[model samples]
Target: MSKITIALEAAVATVIENSPKDVRQTARQRANVDRAFAGILKLIAPRIRHFIRQYGLVAHWDDAEQCCAIAVHRAIEAYDPAKAQFTTFVNWQLRGELQSLRFRLMTDQRPSAKKVEATTVSLHAITVGTEGEEASLESMIEDENALSLTESAASEQMAGDLRAVLIGRYVDHLRDVGMEQLKRAARTKRPAAQDLAKPRFKAPNHGIDPADIADMEAKLAQHVHLVERRIFDDTCLDDLEQEFGIAKERLRQTAKRAAKTIAELAAAEPRFASELNRKLPQRRRPSKAAVQPAVTIVPDQHAAHNLLTNVVAITPEAGEPLAESIDARLAATLTTLVSETLN
Candidate 1:
């Protein structure tokens, strides 16, 4: 749009083409030709900048500029005045070169679309499972070494006793987790209809009878209360030291046994473990009730610390009598009651 560009274009159309006989020979004709070339450069200069930016050629601008210059020159040389306007012809030519330029600058540009190969793995080729009955990798399988069935029980003697400390800590952990989950559930707003349209997850079967849990809880609670009070009393610890040569470690193991029993009890009856989630009262439309999820304890830092502390406290001194007394039997009997279900 510059005056020089406009003038050069007009000059090329009129003066340069019409005065071809005098071109290169006459100084005036040569001036017109030079003007036309300058005009061409001006026309493609902005386009070259655009291509550089569009093709991410800014890092190699000088090279891109040179390429664009060559493309422009080729366009001018190959131009057919009878077929199209100079501007249209130049645009078409530049477009082709720009397409190729874009490919070259792509870093991984290919001549055509990349062909993707279909991938399939032969699971049947691999055999797995126990010796004789081994099946292919495709068939459902499991490792026997990984076959660990967790049962809640202890040695016959200690099975009668349960540790109150472990049960109390487990209860505390459960309460904490329940509070957190309830708070989160309260804060959560229902999703939109579209979101609800998506498939909802179905919880796996717990296989627990809540009624059994209630019965076990009642029996266990009575024992747990009595045992916990005795455990904290120094008289009880001294009695064990004076009568039974029971190791403090044996006490912790006893607690662990009780903890395992509680776990088994809960597993046996999920309903008693946690009440079904009850929604907060609403004045208007009632809200859908959520299922109350049970809390599971995995031994971690806090649990480990609790165990260590209990061990230090319950452990009797080496100087104390290792001999079992009648008083120690009461302690063992009370602890054993934790596992026994009330008739």
Candidate 2:
């Protein structure tokens, strides 16, 4: 076998042999484990540094390196050959640790390119020749600044794209249903029949009495009509009390009693029994339309331009023209994907 492979096998064996069957360790064994850990750290430092640089974690390289070391140590302590290969397991552990560190740094706003550049320039000036150090620091700072700006712009664009995607999806999905409800609610000046239907009515068997079925249907219809009217008319509990000449609590009690009667009636009918199994009441569309036609308030190009300018002024800098353009393109692509998938 190669020297590296042999060394790895030896390390694995050392770890397995040194770990006690019991949780507790003797002083000698503990010392041996510590020595083994130190050896492993030495072997893994270069690997950790390579991973850090690869991930563009130069700003927090020290913390990233320390986290990698901790990850490696954790992997060693928790190592079980039966579960996975040591290297494979350690790599997974290291990657998770690094990702967590990256998320924390990104969200916390402590590690910025400007701060890193300043630190780098100071360190370089102290150790290197003044002119070369100055040039290098300036170059590094400019590059870092550009990268930061690009990343910020990209993030803003992404957020806008996501927002538009959600809004479009939600609005499209609910458009027909919401409009139907609004229209239904508005026109009758009464809530839809379905909303106030008696919950107690059930579909009777073929052999059941026609009178019983008819009575149940009539009650269900009445209940549905009443609830719909109450909602559509915007009748508050106080309004109910005033209209019925009863206390609010008494009105609520009466409604509850009415609901229970409906539920019982519904339970007797097979169709309504199935509906009663549902946890919540059914929603109905409004009779009235929700949206009105757009009005032509501005007749001239100057008026239109002024309106557009006002809108632009109110919009956030993050949501301005350049950012919005990128966001719109991204949203269009995503909308196409959504349409294709639904189709």
Candidate 3:
């Protein structure tokens, strides 16, 4: 190894080295807020044009300029003194933000950098309510998965329907409680053994026997179409009343009571209420076009049965006895064939 001899001199500041007295650097550090946001517009302009041409992400040039300004502001906070220029440091930062914006736009999350101020929603903000002050948005918007009105209403209506069905099921039982109390004369009389033995109605017990409640649920399930039709579609109270042969006022009262009961159930047992939405019946409406094609009773012979059949009138409505007429001689054969096939 060759030995090298070095002579030391007073060091001078190179361009790469930081100068404590540099006026421009000091000004940049102190007065960083520049009113000329359009300063960076030229830098981001070509990129915006390229993005529009290549990706076809529909965003105005002004929007890109604003985003670049925001990124530049953020980058200024992290400006490295070792970097050759502040502008170069900001260029890369602005580029990254624009690229991120492009990716977000591609995914259909169009962020409005200009319109939406850089702020935060305090998810824990306290808001006063009828009951008391409570947690804010985080508490209120609990079900983010339930996004659509139809979906939200379906769940809500199920709970309501279940509550209504429960109320309607216990109508006679509740009425009897009031009636028996009212008819108990001021003067003492012989207490009926059955009345004395009857269970006292305390309500989260639902004022009814558990067996009666189970029976009600079964009945509601069997006639779920009634609830679906009345609550969900073609909600004609008069039609329902006439169809069921119940008094119109009585029907209205029953409906009103059911509504009130559902509200109570929701307040008391919200978790159980939310689960009830799964039980809501969706009404199936068959269009005339859809129905007419599927219903053609083609009287064809079957090899399995070795029977031939002809068709006669089978009326579905009172308008007319609609039927496809086949050979009159085969009418008996067809009737016999149908009976045998069905059996």
Top candidate when judged by lDDT against the true structure? 2
Per-residue lDDT, model 2, residue 333, is 100
Question: What is the total number of backbone clashes in candidate 3?
Answer: 0
**Model number with the top TM-score:** 2
Off by over 4 Å in 3: 1-32, 35-70, 74-92, 98-208, 222-224, 230-343
- For model 2, how big is the CA root-mean-square deviation? 36.1
lDDT of 1 by residue, 98-155 (tens): 6677666563444343344333345676665566676776564445534343223334
Write model 2 residue lDDT over 230-294, tens digit each, in one string.
43344678876665566777656656654454446546657556766878856986788678756
List the RMSD of every prediction in angstroms: 40.3, 36.1, 30.1
**Would you list the clashing residue pairs of candidate 3?**
none
Q: Give candidate 1 regions above 4 Å deviation.
A: 1-31, 105-107, 111-343
lDDT per residue, candidate 3, 1-343, as tens digits? 1111010000111211223455556555333223233333444456546644444445555666566667755765565546545545555776677777675544333355435543444667767666786668777867766668778799889868865655554444445544444344322455335675678554564333456556655555433444445644647878987677767776667666655654565545656566655567879887566444334456444534536555455556632322333355479788999999999
* lDDT comparing candidate 1 with the true structure: 0.57
- The TM-score ranking, best first, is 2, 1, 3
